[model samples]
Target: MRVADVGEFGLIERVTSRLTYGPATLLGPGDDAAVIAAPDARVAASTDVLVEGRHFRRDWGSARDIGHRAAAANLADIAAMGGTPTALLVALCMPPELEQSWAEELADGLAAEAATVGASVVGGDMSSSPTLTIAVTALGDLGGRPPVTRSGARPGDVLALAGRTGYAAAGLTVLSRGFRTPRLLVEAYRRPEVPYAAGPQAAGLGATSMIDVSDGLVADLGHVARASGVAIDVRRDAFEVPPQMRDAAQALGADPYAWMLGGGEDHALAATFPPGVDLPPPWRPIGLVAAGSGVTVDGKPYTGSAGWDHFR
Candidate 1:
């Protein structure tokens, strides 16, 4: 049945009923507002919005995938700040004609992804709209550690990354070109795997600066560079592009390096560490921080476009 058939409160009941939460959630659904425990007495909060045809396409992913992506996008931001996600607030706005089942599936996806990080959806709101939109706000615990912000990189710091890059952008190309590629690549575009632990791990290791690679690696690193007032020189040979990304790029007669440098939504962590600091297992050195400005590839300026922008 359509969402209009059940009304907002009834739909909320159906969606919240299927979720499983933890002790962090003092008061969950069916409350005026969710009360979640902030163990460190400090919470790191971030929000993300996904709009139909802009952030995603219904034809490209199921409601579940859309929800998962929404959760990942917001949670990764928390992780980027060296925090562990504790709870989430999701708001859904959709056309009245949208199916109730779709909303439930979206809720299920949100719950499952949040559970991966031991977080729960504490509260949210629903509204009728002309289109589908998902807005997720994530709250995290820093565990008494200082947040790893983009402004901390030093001139002699080493740049590193945790998790894959360019896979999602390549996946988008594959689908657009109608090329038959590995399911993993396509799924990468639909459901990104964020490195949830690396952010905190980096903080524990004295990372000078950090950010989730939501935008392209170079683009996101540029944020760190500009904020820290340093130059980031990425070593191209350091990147180990998976064969799937290469194959997908070849199919479209496009450069895989472009995707690696420009693709966003990978949810990987890019961090800057002291020159001699030992990086944890998940972190791999991909570049170096120097006294300058902007991001460069192998000591040269990157000429390609700098990742996704909400507006031109």
Candidate 2:
């Protein structure tokens, strides 16, 4: 059945009933607002919107895949701030012709991803629209630690990355070209992986600055470089394209390095720690912060397009 058959409130109930809240929730859905625990006495919040034919394509992914991608994107934002996600408020806008089962599957994907970080969907709003849009607001706890913002990096800091990159962008190319690669690469494009634990770990280890690689490595790092007023030099030799992406690149005759440098939506954490500080697992130094400005690939300015821009 379509969403129009059940109406607004019924659809809300169906989605909310499927989600399970944790101890962090004081009050969940079926309420005016959710009351969640704020042990740090401060909250880190980030919101992201996924629009059909823009952020995702229905034909390219399932409702569950879209839902998980949406959740991962927002959760990574909280992680970028050095906070542990506590809850999410998902606002779904769909056309009346949208199927009810699709909404249910989307909720399942959201809850599944939230459960990984011990978070849940507290509440949200549903409305009819001419197209599909999902807006997710994530709430996180800093655990009494100061947030790790993009502006905190200093000269002489070591740039490290936690989690893989470029796989999603390669996957997108594979899909666009109608080429087939490994299942993982395609799935990476559909539901990018977000290293949830690495966020708080970086904060605990005193990360000077951190940001998620949502809009390609160089583009996102450009934000850090611009914000911190420092130059970031990424080592070209330090990158090793995943074997699957390498094969896909070969098939498409695409530059794997471009995928690594220009790919986005991987949601990997890129952080800077003080020089000589030892990085933990999944965190490896890829570059260094230095005086000056802008981002450089192997000590040279990157001239390619800087990741995704909503307009233009």
Candidate 3:
């Protein structure tokens, strides 16, 4: 049935009824506002919006895929701050002609992704719009640890990364060209595998600065550089190009490094730690923070687009 058939209240009930709440959620959906626990007395909150056509295409992904992507975008931000996600507030605006089942699937996707990090969909709002939009606000707990920021990196810090990069961008390229043979790349674009645990782990290991790699690595690192008043030099050789990426690159005759360096939406975590600290599995040293400003690759300026920009 079409969303209009159920109307607004019905749609809300259908979506909220299927959600499962956790201990952190004191008051869930059907309430005016959600009351989430903040044992640390501090909340790390982040919000992100996904718009149809611009952020996603219905033909390219299922409602669930978009739902997962929407949740990850915000959850990763909380993780980047070295906090554990507690709850999410999702606001969905869709055309009335959209299928009701699609919206249900979207809720399922949001709940499933939140469950990965032990979070829950506490509340949200629904509205009718000419276009489909998913806006999510995620709250997290610091657990008494100081929240990591982008301005803490020092000249002697070790630059590190947690999770894959460029896979989503590569997948975008493949899908844009009308071929999905490289299922790995396509799936990466569909649902990013965010290293949620790595954020708190890095914080526990004394991460000086951290960020979610929603923008391209260089672009996001540029934010860290400017904020910390330091320069970041990434080793091109440090990135390991997977065979799938290489095959896709060869097929399209595109530079995988461009995607790796400048692609966004993978939601990986980039952090800087004190020198001599040992990085655990999945967190590898990618470069170093130095005494200058701006981000560079192999000691030279990056000529390609650093990352995604909403407006040119």
Top candidate (lDDT): 3
Look at candidate 1 and tell me the lDDT of residue 10.
Answer: 95
By lDDT: ranked, best first: 3, 2, 1
* Model 2 steric clash pairs: 216-263, 216-264
The candidate 3 region of ten consecutive residues with least summed lDDT is: 303-312
Tell me the tens digit of each residue's lDDT in model 2 across 219-267.
Answer: 9999999999999999988899777878878878889898888889989
In terms of TM-score, which candidate is strongest? Answer: 3
Task: Give the winner by TM-score: 1 or 3.
Answer: 3
Per-candidate TM-scores read: 0.98, 0.98, 0.99
**Candidate 3 CA-lDDT value:** 0.94
Error of 1 at 116 (Å): 0.4
Query: In angstroms, what RMSD does candidate 2 have relative to the true structure?
Result: 0.9
Better of 1 and 2 by lDDT: 2
lDDT of 3 by residue, 1-312 (tens): 999999999999999999999999999998789999999899989989998988998988898998899999999999999999999999999899999999999999999999999999999999999999999999999989999999999998999999988999999999889987699999999999999999999999999999999999999999999999999999999999999999999989999999999999899999999999989988999999999999999999999878887866
Which regions in candidate 1 have their CA more than 4 angstroms from the true location?
none
| Candidate 1 lDDT trough over 10 residues, lowest sum | 173-182
Residue 55 C-alpha lDDT in model 3: 91
Q: Over 4 Å off in model 3, which ranges?
A: none
